[model samples]
Each structure stands twice: as structure tokens, then as C-alpha cells.
Target: MSLPPAFLDELRARVPLAPVVGRRVKLTRAGREWKGCCPFHNEKTPSFYVNDDKGFYHCFGCGAHGDVIRFLTEQEGMGFIDAVKQLAAQAGMEVPSESPEARARAEVADTLQSLAGRAAEWFQAQLRSTAGAEARAYLDRRGVSATMIKDFALGFSPESRTALKTALKDAGEDKLVEAGLLGRSDDGQTYDRFRGRLMFPIRDRRGRVVGFGGRALGDIQPKYLNSADGPLFDKGRLLYNLDRAGPVAHKSGRLVVVEGYMDVIGVAQAGIAELVAPLGTAMTETQLALAWRQVDEPILCFDGDGAGQRAALRACLRALPLLAPGKSLRIATLPPGEDPDDLVKRGGAPAFEVVLDAALPLSEYLWRSETEGQDTATPERRAAVRQRLKAHADAIADPSVRALYAADFNARFDALYFARPERPPRQAFVRGARYVAPLAGASPALRSRGPGARTASGEVTALLAGLLTHPGLADRHGEALAALPMSDPRQAELRDAILSALALSPDLESDALNADLVRRGVGGLADATLKSNRLRFSFTRRDAAADATARDFGMMVDTIAARTRIELELETATARFRSSLEDSDFERQQALLAERVEIDSAMMRLAESLRDD
Candidate 1:
């Protein structure tokens, strides 16, 4: 819900900007005002001046100037509504209701957050009390000290089924209901979500207590489980130990992503505080991107289980395409069935550290470890492995890493390792060795255009791109382009992106054009189309007549336009289908399914028609 504007305005009134921003920068007294360096932008000298009289701040360096609301939005990376909420809290002032909807929603979040805060305190309090004896003992047996448990906000949920439910009822049961802490029966009886479990408050990197991970206290059916889906937590996205380990990982220059939560806790407790874990899901692309942002390299320590070995292989595979120039990925394989946590317990944290230090680069590990003894003694087997190695090496996104790995791989596998006992030279495969899951159920569509098909489509996209990029072309070409049909959906999207870009801005630059297209959901379409335009430009820029360029553009445009018309026709056929048809029954259903399949297949082809820039 949108916030009441007045609440935000009043929030701006409280916690006067001069004082709030003054503490962050070196401010000089300048006639009822102050001046300091612009925190938003880099500046050699102080150009950020503040007027205490008006509660306004301005940076002459980058033209970033605003009041407290703007300050929080720019500096703290907070939304306007959240910043106002924060500023209101700073002022010790309750934000008066602005709108009915905003009031109701904010009240819900506020009440739940308050209830969670109180509940967290109670749980931590229990860890010190006698009721928490078992939980404390469990941690002690696991070698987690009081200091580490306290630091991680670790605590116990008493064996009673409703200890937290009763506590939250007294504090506020409405909050319990809202936060999903209580599960209601048909008769209105409520029970706790977690029972007889040890609690670990799951936190976001910013240290907000979003949810919880609960462990079964004793031998039970399921072991070491986390809370089910809640309003605040999505297990797939959350990383255990991120709050405690992120900074240390960032500071220490490497992150260790172990497979389990206790392993994270164990490693951190052992003073190897740079450990993190995914919330029991496979390491996803989103997690990789988030991990990449915090550190230069990540060492994945999968357990010694078979599943762990597969996970380690997957980590190497996924990291292949995402390997950046400076970033590195290393895989640390633990001994059979032992994880970092178990290893740390048996051999101490130093043992885990030694394993991490011995971690090999992902490419090296995947190529060498898997193929070290797999019939490599035979020439044919070595040839197959070497070919696969070359393919994986080619998949590395960083050129330098690829080059260095290639050199090292060649040095390791000399002529002594060969096929048919003949000396062989390294060769580049047409398509590299990395395996990409096909788009759903189908194989990769042909990316290369059919003979003479490329030039016409290329010209058309370039023309549309120019018309969209420069408004002047639309005036010249608007009338000559309406006769033919484009049979591709990607062509339609490209045309739409061009038209949309033209409507928003007459003289479109690259960034603005691409951003507008992305906002419209044909995100990368504009970039690909523009790259095609660049190709056409480079090819024909010298001594090509304006008419020739336009003619070539016209050719490509007609081809794409034809594809787009066909796309709309196919879309119309599938849009009118029903799950339960009244007319022809099975025959209609089968026909509808076929039409839908064709449309989908056609769209896939259309997308593939536009290759990588």
C-alpha cells in the first residue's frame, strides 16, 4: 500500500536533516548552515552544502540535493516509505494514519515485527534459563560456546507444543496469527509452527530477523529441518549464516559456502567465521550472484556424500558461465561422508581450513578428479577426456582463466596421454563441451540463419532499430512497411520495442533505449536488435548510399514483419481455446492442443532466430 504523504512529510519535519547528515560528513559552520563532502558521489573537495535554516542539503559536485527523505533514499538504499518509517522512529514519534489502506497494512507489519522481537527475546532468555538446559547441552556437545550461540541469536523452543504460542498470546495473539506463528484449526484453536525444537533465527544479510530454522531436539523422524514457508522467508532464497559470516567473508577475501546450517555454525564457532550455506536448496544462480557481490572467490565445500559429489559437480558447472575476470571458484571435497561441520568437530577448525586451502580450481577439480583413473590409461579414453576438458575450459567466461587453465591442462596431459599412441594437437570443438539444460523439453533451435536469410532479417531489424532510435526515419519509412507479415514473435517484440522507444524519446541513446525495452519485457530484445544494427552499420557504413542502406534495412524489415504477422495469427488460434469445450469435445481439445504446441514451437524458433550479439 502507498504511504500517507503527510506521514512522510511530517517524518521529514522530525530528525532535522542538518543533524542527521551532519554526523556523517565533516561540516563547516557557514552562516546558519554547513558544508561537507558529497557522500553520494566522489569529490576531491567539499561541495555538499547544507542549509540548517531550511533543512535542505545540496551537492554541487553531482547535483544530488534533497532533504532527509532523499538522503535516506540515496545513502541508505531504502525505499521512500521505509525511510519515512525509520525517520519517524528516530524522532520518537508515532506516525499518524495517512490512508486507511496504508494504516491497515503498516499496522499488520508493525504488530508482527513487534511480536517477533518480543518472541526472539523470550527464546534467547530461555537459552539462559533452566528450561533451555537441553538446548544448551546440545550446543555444548556440538562444541558451540555460549559466546557464539549468543552472537548468532541461537536459542531454544521448549519441548512443550505451545510455549511460544502461549507467550505470543499474552504479548499479542493477533500478531501470532499475522506472522504465521500460529496454525488455526477449524474450531479456532491455534498451535505453534515449531515444537520441541531448537531455534536459529534466520536473518537477511542486513541483519533483519526474517524467519527461523528449527532443529529437532532428539532422535526423531526428520532431522535438522527449517521452518515452513512464512510471510518473511522463502527458503530457496535465504542463506544460512549470511548475517554472521558475510562481513567476515568480505573482509577475509574469500567465502566458504558449506552445505548445511550446523556446518556453518560449527565453522564459525571454530573461528573460521567466513562460512555460509544455502537454505537446503541446490545453489541457485541468484545465490551465486549474491555470493559474487560479497567476495572475489567462493570455495564450495560439499559433503563427502554421493549427493554432495553431484552438488560439487553442479557448482563447478554453473560457475562456468558466470566466471568473471577477477572472480574465482574452488571446490573443496571432504573425505567420505564427512562435511565441514563433522570434519571440524573431528579434526578441529584448522582441519577445515586446511581443506579449504587445498581446494582446487573448479575446472581442475572437475576435469582431473573425475577422469584421473577412468580408463585414462587407454588412448581413446584419454582423447575423450581431453576433448571434454577443452570444452569445459572454453566455457569459462574469463579469458585469462580459460587461457591459464588450458595451458596447465596441456602441461599435465603430455603426449604420454594420447589416442592410438599418436601425438595429437588440441582442437576447438564447434560447440564447446559445457552442458546447458535445453529450454524445457526441446533441443536448441538453430541459431545460424538459413542461406541468404541473415541479410534480409538483419537489414529489417536495423531499419526498425534506426526508426525507433531516430524519429526522423519513421517519417520516411512509415508508409512503405505495412504490406508484409512477420512470422516471428521475436520480430513482433522487436517492432514493439522500437515503437515504444520512439514514443518515449525521439532521439534514443543505447542505455535509455535498452532500459525502456527491458521495462516492457522485451528486455534483451533491444540490445540484440541494436547489435544487429551495429553489424549492418559496420558492414555498409563506407560508401553505401542512403537508399542502399534503407533498401537493405527494408529487406530485413519485410522479412521480420512477415514473421510477426504469422506470430499474431498463431497467438489468436490458441487464445480462444477452453479446457472444457462445449462443441467438439475430444477432437476440439486435440486440435486446440496442437495449435498451442505449434504456437509455442514457433515462438521458440522466433527467439532462436535472433542469435547472440
Candidate 2:
């Protein structure tokens, strides 16, 4: 018995050919086609090619050529009818018997395709008529050139209920309704489904018009209207403009997926011909599979706004389960408040090209989406970040990919939390009026200035600025700073006052730290220090500045403490040498001389380190 031609076509379209042949053959992607050894004959080198895009398999060595049905019969050693039955069962299609009802239905399907083509032509004629003048003006205002209008086959539908019904009266009411071009009321009244709107013809892969999508000219609810699914149009199975973009994508090795029809047209007008858009919905798996068939990685161009970001996240989640070794997506976000159409019109094609060139890979986009705007300052928040990352990584179906994601996230966490700089040891020293004189080799003016000199003053200023810009540094290093000896009496008083305030209140950010300093009555000093050295320690990114300050502040504190210890030792050694004398005190004098030499060496090293800092 012969099966219905429609059933066979649907089976072939639904079942991808690569997986069917890959059951026995170890096929690998070679450019746009999958290559494997010919199953019919033994051969070491692979010359057999299977192309899902073209829906055929060809062997270069043996010159074997056929469709999916032919492959099943020949490879599996099954008869033609048996192969059809098995493939039909796998595709969830019922094989047809020689019955009158089935034949009538198949004929109806053919008639619907014919009617849909005629309806598209009728809409095109309406667009040229006087009734479509408003639609023409709207297109002109959008900067759509006449050539694009013709190429995209844009049209218009009139508001009259009977215009389409009257145009295709020869096809009868039931046929037009079956074609999804007209709707029927309960009382037997038939009206146009799409009226007074700009029309876009939706075509199948073979470039045949299967349905229409209409955009309203005025404030209509549901800004766009698409044809209801029927015999020819399966919304999920076909992408808009695929018939045109397929060849361009094959040549360019890239495919750009956008949100709407106009975006597709605008991008193509900007000289990028390899692009497609979904049919008035979020991208489906079938659409992604179609894109992957053309190119391994398609660039998804979304808006930079909140809604667009949400769409991108949704796409990433859906694609995780379907990901293979070399197949994925790249995401390009347009500038804020701009879509592809808006961007091209304002800055020309190069602006859109810039966004495409900087597209983020799937892994990078996923990481940023999960971690953006999250603060890891507190333990609770840091744990929350890790959990969120794990949840996303675990969703990936591929085990190896999940492992890689886990390792990357853990490394990033360590950099943020565990990787800390070493703190040099602080030595004991005498507290002498909270003052230490500058180096002896200094100029007379510098020596006379004492602690108030610009060099020393600048050091204190920078330290205070670091604490102010990254107040969390204060929380982490407050205990050390409170116990360390100070060289300036004013700075010592300020430190004690601020530390006392911070002891009472924790989680004080930069602004709160400033407020606490103000309450301590040392606000003026803090203000002056920040104002003078704004260039040296200005606030930029909080996270980056905090990391740098955490290292620099510790080093500065240790340097100061080291210098103080060396000076105190020098004083003690000089006193001992003067007090001890004669043969009986010879050993004490020699001990004093050794102590003086050690102090001088330490002082030199500290001075050099300070100069380097």
C-alpha cells in the first residue's frame, strides 16, 4: 500500500537525518555537513556526508545519493514499506491506508497551500491601493527603502470584512477559512482575520508563503497578529526569513537572531545579510536547532534593557540541555534604550557591527548574569552567590561542562575571599611623645619641618584617604591600627576616637565612617586630607580600590612600626656607651657598639623600603 505523500513529508521534516544515520556510523561535523565512513562498504577514510540542512546523505567515494527513507531501507536491509512503517512510528505519525477520507484530506492540504499563496498576492495588491496609503506613509517614516519593501514582500490588509472574502471568492468560504485567511462567526458570518494592518508573508524553507504576520497601524491590542497554525505553517518549526538567510549564513559562517521582524530587516539593510528572527515569540528549541544547522554559534542580539536581559537569560537556560561539544550561542546586547533598528538608523551599520563583534560567549554571559549586582561582603551573601552559581551549573546536562563551571567559579571565589596578602611583623618600640624625627641625611628645611613636613603629611593623608574610600578596610584592619604606635599626636587622637566609634557600630560603609569621624569632632582634619589628595586616592570602583588598599595599608603600618623600633634601640645603645668606661666595663662597651651597628643597618633598610613605597 502507498502512504500519503503529506505523511511522508512531515516525517522527513520532523526526524533529523544525522541522528538517524549516526546510530551505526560515527559521524563528526565537517564544516556545514556531517562526515562519516560509508556504512554500505568498509573504508578507513571518511567520504560519506550527511547534511540536515539539505535533508540528504551523499558518499563521495561510492557516489551513493538518497533521502532519509532511502538510507533506512538500504542500511537496515529492510523493504521500502517496512522502512516507511518504522520511520513513521518513530516520528509519531500514523501510516495511511488506501481510504477515500485520507485522500480527500490530502487534497484539501494542497488546496490550502494554493489559497495561501493567492491571499498573499491579494494583500500585496491591497498595499498598492489607495486604502493602504496610511501603511505606505508608516513604512516611509520608518526609513524603509522602496527596494527593501519589495524584497521583504511587505503588504497591507484592508479593514473591510469582505475584502479578502471578495478577492478570493473562487476558492469558497470554507477553503479560505481553512487557509487561516478568514474567520467565521457562530451565526455563519465570515470576516478577515487580519484587517487594517501591515502584513509580512511567512514562508517555509523552500521559499513558499505559508502564512502571514500583521502589525497594527494604530493602537490595537496585541501590536502584532500572526496567522493561526494550519496545514502549511507550524510556528515553532520555521523561523522568519530563514529561506533568505540560509545561503548568506552558509557563506559568512555566522547567523544573527533578533527579537522581531523589523529588527531582521533593519540589520539586513545595514549590510549584514545573515540574520533571522523568531515568529513573534521567544526562541524555541526547533528554532535553535535550525540555527545550529546553519552555523555552530549564532549571535543573539538583544536589547540592553531589563526585558531584553530577561529574554537572554531564558535563552541560556533553554540551551543548556541541548548543548553539544561545538554548538552554542553568542549574545550581543544593544546599547541601553536601543534595538537593532534604532541603532542602525542613528549610527549607521558600523555601530551594529561593533555590538556584534563584542558578543559574549555562552559561559561568560551566564556567569555575569548570575553574579551581577551581588555583594559578597558578608558571609551570608557570599554563600548565596556560590549556591546560585551551583544551581545554574548543575542545570547543565553535560557532566564535563558542569565540572568546568564549578572549577572556574571556585577559583573566582578564592581570588575574592581566600587570596590575602602577607602582613609584616610589628616590633616593640618606646612611645616618645608620638614623634619620630626624619632621616639624618635630609635637607635642613625638611629636618626643621618635623612631622608636619609634606612627605610625612602626604603619607598620613594617603592612608586616611584609603580608609575613607574603602571603609571595609577599616573594619578588617581596625584592631591592628588601634594598637600600633603613631608619630603624629593629632593622628593618634583621631585614630583612637574613630576606633572607639567603630567599636560601637559595625558594618559602617564609607559614608557612615565619615559620619562617625564627624561625631568625634575630627571631621575637619579628615575633610582637609581628602580634599588635598583627591588625585592620589579618589573613589572609583569600590571593589578594586578596597583590594589595593588592603595590601598598601598593611605595608605602611609595618614600615612605620619598624622605623620606630630602630630609633629606640639607637637611643638605648648610645646611653649605655656613655655610662660604661675603663677595663672593667670593656665587655659592656663592646656590647653597646654591636647594638649600635645592628640599629644603623635596620634604619638604612627601613629608609630604602619607605622610599620605594
The prediction achieving the highest TM-score against the true structure is: 2
lDDT of 1 by residue, 1-613 (tens): 3567776666677678887786667788876778888776667788778775566787645556578877755554344555666788889877666578767876666666666666678778887889888888888888887788878888777777678887766756555866656667789877787666788887765566766777888886566666556555567777777766665654456788888778888887777888888877788876787677656678899998999988878877777777776776888889997988889788887898788889987667876765776876667887887787777768887754664555456545652453244345333222253222121211222123221222245545655565545444443454445333343558655665554444324466545666777876786776676666644442134344556556544554554554543333322222222211223333433454355456546534543543233
Pick out the ten consecutive residues of candidate 1 with the lowest summed lDDT.
437-446
Worst 10 residues of 2 by lDDT: 434-443
At residue 538, candidate 1 shows an lDDT of: 20
RMSD of each: 15.1, 28.0
lDDT of each: 0.64, 0.72
